[model samples]
Each structure stands twice: as C-alpha cells, then as structure tokens.
Target: MPDSQTLGNRTRGMGEIVDIAGKTTEIAPFGNTLAELGRERPEIVGLTADMGRYSDILPFRDAHPDRFFNVGMAEQNLVLIAAGLSKVGKIAYCTTYSVFVTRRAYDFIAIACAHSMANVKIFAGMPGLLNGYGATHQATEDLNMMRGIADLTIIDPCDATELKQVVRAVADIPGTVYVRNLRGKVPVELPADYKFELGKAKVLREGNGEIGMISTGYMSARGLDAARIVQSEGHDVGLLHVGTIKPFDKKGVIEFARRHKRLIIAENHKTTGGLASLVIEALYEAGVYMPVVKIGLADSFFECGSQEYLEKKYEVDLPRFVRAIREGV
Candidate 1:
C-alpha cells in the first residue's frame, strides 16, 4: 500500500501541469444576467459590501441605480439589509467575497436568511483559490461552512455560461441561496442551449468505464481539460459537472458513478466537507464500492500568487488531475 502522506507530498509538488496558457477573458455574465433579470423582475434588489465592481454586479447597479445599495465594507450589515428587503417581499441579491460571506456574516446568513427563510441570494466572489489573494481572501472552506446551514441552497457554477444560468435560476427560488460567483474574465464552457436547474447535475461526456471525473464550480473546466489528456493517452475517462454543490444531486452522482469502475471528485474547494465529501457520503449510503480519488486543496492555508501557480502548489491544477486520472490514484 502507498504511504498516504508520502503520496500526498509527491502529488502536491507535481509541478506545472500545462504552461500558463489562455488569455484572461473578461465577461460579466453574473452582472449581465442579473441586470436582465432585474428588468423583468421588479422585486429583485442588489446589495453589495462595497464590492460591486469586484463581484461583477456593476451592470446591475448601473442599470437599476435606484434598486442598488452599497453597504460599504460591512458584510454583516449587507446580509441584514438583504434580510430586511426580503421581509418586504423583495428578492435580495447580496454581493461580497466568499470569505467575507462565510466568515464575517455567517450569523446573518444562518439566522437572518436561513432561519427566517428569506428570499436572499448571496452572490460571493473569490471562491476557493480563484483569488490567490492569500488566506484572508481565498475561501477554500466556504462551501463547507455554508453547506451546513439548513434551508440554504448552495451553488458553485462551472463557468460563465453556467454562472448566467444559475443566476437566473436562483432568483426564482423562494428561500435563501448562496452562490459561488465567478468574476473577471469568466470562461464560457457550457453549450449555448444548456439549461440550469436547481439541484441537478449534468453529464458532459460519457467515456469508457475506466474512470469517471466529477467536478463542481470552475474546476469542471479544468477536469475537462485533464480528461482530454487522459483520453489522448488511451484511457477511458468521463466527465460530470455538478454545478449545484448543496442539495447535492445524489441520484445523478450514483447514476454517473455506476458507469465507471473508478471515480474522481475534482473541485476548487478543500477536500473535506465539500463536493468530495458529498460524493463519498452518497456512495457510502448507497453501498457502492468504487475506488474514489479527490483532487483539491489540502488542509492548509494558501499563499499569494497567480491563480494557476496557487492551483499547482495545492495540487488541484489541471496536471495533478490528469496524473490522478491516468495513474488511478
């Protein structure tokens, strides 16, 4: 048997998977989608903890100046205001960094929104390692924290396309929703006609029954890239995009995993209590015995660097996923 710690160290320093490739594409799908929805839904109100620009909600703010509220750097107050708006029968769409929402304003989210069942939508930016702004900003455990809240829907979209679809879908839901928002040059990976439904997972590709890759948030894009490399090397690897993290689609996961002998859960968040945990729990409950591999951040704080550099350091980059899928780790 492989020493788990030694294997972990080897995997963490696997070096650059692929060169820092691809130009940064800036598309404000979140803000754009909100703006479009706001025009159609009058009850939609936008709130920000002075992160309107960073969270990509500027388009919504600009379009509905009267309906936008900047709550400054006070994240707790932001949730409070959102809760109040929800009480008044308005759909509150709050914006802030993932750390701010999970750390600073967790109470308001749990009590003000979740407890009261407010129609508040918290759109959080800088999800997991996407920020690379050090420990203070990287929300590697946001999903873990937010998922424990009862009556709160957790969503981690895969790309700009899914981001737009999720934004529109969450607005229609009645209770509290926590969304892992992607900002600044978000990539468009999903098909144009793809529709987003709450608590449903989508299977992107059906590979040979050798390996199945399950991914959430933007990590699905990375998983796809890794799957391509695995396929090129003559391995049969499939891809499943679990966009909705909480209220996890267990039926979808079980069905997808049934088609493969080994399964890998790839996510941008930490290994524990996130997508990997959900998959493991589902598998255990169903008495499935497939070997599972997890590709995500280890139990540690992050450093400041470019997104790609941080990803490689944590062994959650494209190359690490490729290595795990190819080697059956």
Candidate 2:
C-alpha cells in the first residue's frame, strides 16, 4: 500500500477536465451508428429537444431528415412526441440532457413511456458527473430516479463500442429504455471485436485475492486504469464493467464477488440507490458477505465547475481509487 504522503500529493496534483482544442475525437458514435441504422430500419426515427448538435444526433438528422423531429426546448413535449411516434409503430429515439429527460420529463417517462410500454429509447446525454453546470446540469441521481420507474430498462454503456451496440439492442425491445449517453467525441475503450449484450456484465480484467473493481459508464475507464496501477504496485485487482444498470447482472455480480475477498464498486453517479445499492442488495439476497467500498459522488448536489474539476473534488477518479485501496477504506 502506498503511504498517505504519496497518495495525498498525487490527489492534489490531478489534472482538470478539459477537451483537446485541436485534436479530433472519433465521430460521435451514437450519431454515426444511428445514421447507419436508420438506413436499414426506416421505422427508427430521431427526436431531440433542440439539442441535435449537442446530443450528437445530428448525423441521424442529416441522414434521415424526413424521419427526424426537433421539438424545441420543451422536454415534456420531447418525450410525449416520442411516445406518440412509438404508438404509431415507430421506434422513437429521443435525445436530451439526462437532467432534462429525468427531471423535466419524469412524469411523461413514467406514464407515457414506461407505463404504456412505449418503444421509446431516451438516449440521455451528460449523465452523472459528465456536465459541470452545477446541480441543474449534472444528473448525478438519474439512475436512482429512473430505476424506480417500473419496467424501464436502463443502460449506461462504457464507451463507443458498447454505446453503438446498446442503441441497436434496445431498438428491438418492446418497452422503454433509458440510455446514459456520451455526446461529442466519445472515447473508444473496448477492443474492435467486443460484442455487447443487453442485461449482461463484461469482465474486462481478471485478478484475484485483492479488490474486485466493478464500474459502469465512463467510470469503467477510470477503474481499468486504477486496476493497472494496483497491479504495478504488486497487488491484484479485477474489473467488471456493468453497463446495464436497471436489470443488473445478478449472476455475474455474484460470481465476481465470490472470487475476490473485497470489492470496490465505482460509478459516476451518487452511491445511494444506484449501482452500489443494487450490488449490495443482490449480495444480501444471495447470502454473500464481503467488505465493499464505493467510489462515487456523495449524497449531495455538485456546484458548477469543469467536469474534470468536479470529479477530482468529489474523489471519483483513478487517483481516488488508488488512495482508497492503499488506505484500506
């Protein structure tokens, strides 16, 4: 384990979150994938609440302009319109900020989409701590809120690879699906041959007798980095990427926990009522007991700052994981 002095200095010197000004990232995956899928499936339609460009659905708009609808800034109307389209046998894929989709359109999502079992896929951008515009923009509690909506399938893909596959997988499902999205310049984390399946967890790295690091969304990238650091320091750690949130992979989670003596569950959202709670609940039901640690936001709203700054301050990054593992917390 690293000493406190070493860990503290590393934490204090963490870099702020900022986009590269010049270098181009991969063409937004969701937009490009949707555009390609739209050519094959005419029933797939795109909609956004005036966030076509921000949410990266513009490619779909350009590809199938006739099937796209921009409903201005009314989020409720955004969801309601999607429900209407779904009712008419269209697979409606709506894009918006996760904050708006989960906060402003909660009722419409619960009633119109989930209650009615509408085939509406809400691809929400800036989920969890992705945004830095204070509490109003950062949707740190969306997974908790959306999970309570009965029968709603929730997904938080790790990267471009999983996001593209998730979009296609949920399109054929019969009910409402909530996808936490990465809008512009989405990173590619998995290998080219990685295949994504709904309601399954992927074991990205294998280690034993130390920490079982399970993560979701972009945080999985951080977890993988942390695992590498732990291994370099002569400790063993494993990483299980649980991209599916609502219908969590209970069997996979149990099997992973059984292999390791301790667990560190990392996520970008609040620890309460989210992935940590789901995993704990599953372990309890299965009579599996192991010391667990959570790396995520506290039960509080974040103030305005850059996404990188907020993540560092809240201690949800790779450095935080290393420190926690060293301190045995």
Q: How many steric clashes between backbone atoms does each model show?
A: 2, 0
**lDDT of the candidates, in the order given:** 0.84, 0.84
lDDT of 1 at 307: 64
Name the 10 consecutive residues with the lowest summed lDDT in model 2: 9-18
Model 1 agreement with the true structure over 247-276: per-residue lDDT tens digits: 899999998998899999998889998999
Q: Write the per-residue lDDT of candidate 2 for residues 116-183, one digit (tens) a residue.
A: 99999999988877776788888889999999999899999988888999888988877999999887
Angstrom error of the Cα, residue 59, model 2: value is 0.6
TM-score of each: 0.92, 0.92
Considering only N, C-alpha and C atoms within 3 Å, which residue pairs clash in candidate 1?
25-185, 26-185
